[model samples]
Target: MSTERFVIIGNGPAANEAATTLRQRAPQSGITVFGKETTRSYKPHLLPDVVAGRLDAEKIFASPEDYYNERDIQLRLGQKVVQVDFNKYQVILEHREVVSFDGLIIATGGKPRIPEPLEVFEDVMMTLKTTEDARLWIDRLARVDSVLMIGGDLTSLSLTRALINIGKKVFFIIDAESFWPLPFNERLHQEIHARLREKGVDVSSSRKIKRLTQLSDCSIQVETDCADFEVGIVGAFFGLVPDVRFLARSGLDIDRGILVDENLQTRFRNVFAAGDCAQVYNPVIRDYWVSIGYDNARTLGRIAALNMLGGMIAAQASPESIFSLNGVQVNTSWWMEF
Candidate 1:
């Protein structure tokens, strides 16, 4: 039996896929998955459905309760990896627990990017990045009749539709800057505004947010250059940034994310990064690109695992660029097949 110990840092699609692939290829390998979230991996795309009351919260889980146990995978939930010691081949948990590994797969995923103007008021800003965030929105929505959404993305669009479908008033400030990496042309921006207006959304053209004031009734007052509005909550959906703060000192080539070769292997051959947290090299472009979405994450995870096992399989470029949104073609990296 091979005694190779593998460490995967994440509990999302990429992390789970890597673990499964590793277990299959190396049956006797010691595999441990560290998830910051207490819950198991779940479909983040289905979160809007849960918030809209269309799907049950329990149905979001991507795997069965005993999936890891059946596969003999060590699953450590709620343990945030604070740092990685590449030289020592060790990972330090938040509580300073150190675990050594022969192979390491980093699939830390992305975190919600809060707009610069609203950074100070992040405490009151609602974001839908995980199941927990969705549950919080669901609970908060029950008490309010209207919501103010700042910024726009595929997730934001879906959540807006969900909110409207549930008979809640939505005031949207369409920020083109939120759709980074996605070509947000003026024509497309205007089209989004038109579509949102057609869907009964109070679409505001203003992009500048002056201030946010918390009201005594547990509501928020948004002051924009165009108008002032008060709502139960302010949702920020400015896309995502790599959640690689923990690896800041790991000495991995870091741009917006950890840079990896076409084989998903870092400069250190034993280390690999995949999913949203990895900026992979695109041979065609001769540049690095960060691929998002569930499909891309799963594909990259599998490729990363294969390369970790001494296979030289290059990752393909993400094929998800444009998706139809209610008859409108929207360009985004966050598109899900579902």
Candidate 2:
């Protein structure tokens, strides 16, 4: 018998979990994980801490170096898969390196949305999606006394709170009247808003940002339909859309994301997708969503690995509930916004 070769293209929770499960399911198999980001796989919730300097990049790894070494897994960091040869079972990386695999997992995850107004100030405004993004924000913290956040998703809210805790005044603007569009009791959502307000977040809902202008002090002044607000830093967290732009040439099923079955396997039998890059339908609850958060990603990744090994375990869908401000809620995940 010959050992199987597995390749996972991503560094988030899904890619990490899939590689780990593959190692456990087939001890003799060679597992490789390729990540576009150079940083280790850390919890998304810890990104705010990374930006605030509360946790270093090395300390925030969800699956640190030891985990990979203990499982005899290979880590390929800072490598982007430019193309996939479905006919040959090979992937071409940005540097023109070609790697072959028997099974592949596409856990490319999602990218943050940038508003049209902020596009011109590419050097000024920022989005928090990777450790590199956090590093950029952290580098400017010395000159940033306040932050203007322009979304109400989990990423935006968490960064707002983290900045506030670090003594940076935060001004938040959202399209909706409430906070995250989770299944929160209206009262709970109001309570969450009140708590954020008490903690010094200047939140403005139902507002539209027209454009961004540079003030005399090099700070960013947001021009909205209602009024103008100036801040030393500007960040937007309009949540994420699947990073499936690269898969267009692959000819796989893609609508909102790479469509996958209950087993997390894609149309191509050897190729699977998980994490924010996958849109799955759960037969148990008869619900469909673009999976977000770490827990759901892990579940799909594990299920993908099992299905690859001819196991019959189905991907379990994590329930979407009200996201808590104090980090006490479970089954919490965010869907598409705008």
Candidate 3:
């Protein structure tokens, strides 16, 4: 076997799993993980549970520092990849250091999409992407009397429940016609709506926020299509786009995410992307999009590692899943077709 080094640029579950798999498959291959966060990769999808006080932050981590140490993979936390050079297969970090990799995997997760113009007032809102974001909300929750949450996704609904549990008045604004547009049907939406309202959350559907105005007192006035509502804080969890800026300039075919073939190979023969960042041809959906859940990330990571090690495996279909909150428990499970 060749002693080629593999580099993973991300701090999320995808990056962690891929690194672990690479170590197991190619013991001699030097594996290094570069993350923009301070802590080991944690499950970001469970950030709401952490905010809701249902889960401890430490328990949300897929693996700990000792786990990585046991695998002999180098860990570089709290580091951001500023730019990349595909021609040279090198990456530039915020610290002005250049790292080169023989095999590269871009597992960088998406950033929270704050609407245009409103992004100028970042202090009035928070986006839940990393542990820092979750911790910030935990500290702010006590100071805020009311929360204006924007989005109808599962994460937003869970955050609404958490805010209401803490006795903070909650107003949910959704631009969609229904809650959780893809996974839930009308019946399921009504069921969820009833449950949320019973918990004292005000749910507003088919509403769009025009702009966010910060008052002199630091309260936020959310101007919507229907009317204006004032609250102490605003949280948005619409969804995530693929984190592909580094790969964008690499000449790799990118659609929703970095495009890879059935073998998980990018246009560059030595590079492969997996997890939520890699868009592979889906047999069921008949298109490539970043796989959205943790299980998909795990499978894709293993697949990528195997492909990188020059192994052949059958491609499997991607599954659909949904996240739901049952009281204090956050249940994220596979969504089966009836």
Winner by TM-score: 1
TM-score per prediction, in order, is 0.94, 0.87, 0.86
- How does model 2 score by TM-score? 0.87
Q: Which stretches of candidate 1 lie over 4 Å from their true place?
A: 318-338
What tens digits encode model 3's per-residue C-alpha lDDT throughout 1-338?
35787888886777777788888878888998998889987877688879878889998988765988888889999898877777888888999999998888778856666556456756677778788889988887766698887766656766776777778898876544223224445776677667767888888767767778777444778888789878888887665567887666668888767887766778886788777677676555555544666776777777877888887653465344322322111112323221
Q: Rank the candidates by TM-score, best first.
A: 1, 2, 3
Instruction: Give each prediction's root-mean-square deviation over alpha carbons.
Output: 3.7, 4.7, 5.1
Better of 1 and 2 by TM-score: 1
Ordered from best to worst lDDT, the candidate numbers read 1, 2, 3
Native-to-model Cα distance after best TM-score fit, residue 228 in candidate 3, in Å: 2.8
* Cα RMSD for predicted model 3: 5.1
Model 3, residue pairs in steric clash = none
Backbone collisions counted per model: 0, 0, 0
Local accuracy of candidate 1 as per-residue lDDT tens digits, 1-338: 25799999999999999999999999999999999999999989889999999999999999999999999999999999999998899999999999999999999989999866679989888899888898899989989999988888778888999999999999988887776545677897888888899999998866588888989455888887777878998899888788998788788999888899989999886899999899887676667777778888898899999889989999876435533322222223454321
Candidate 2 at residue 159, lDDT?
A: 78
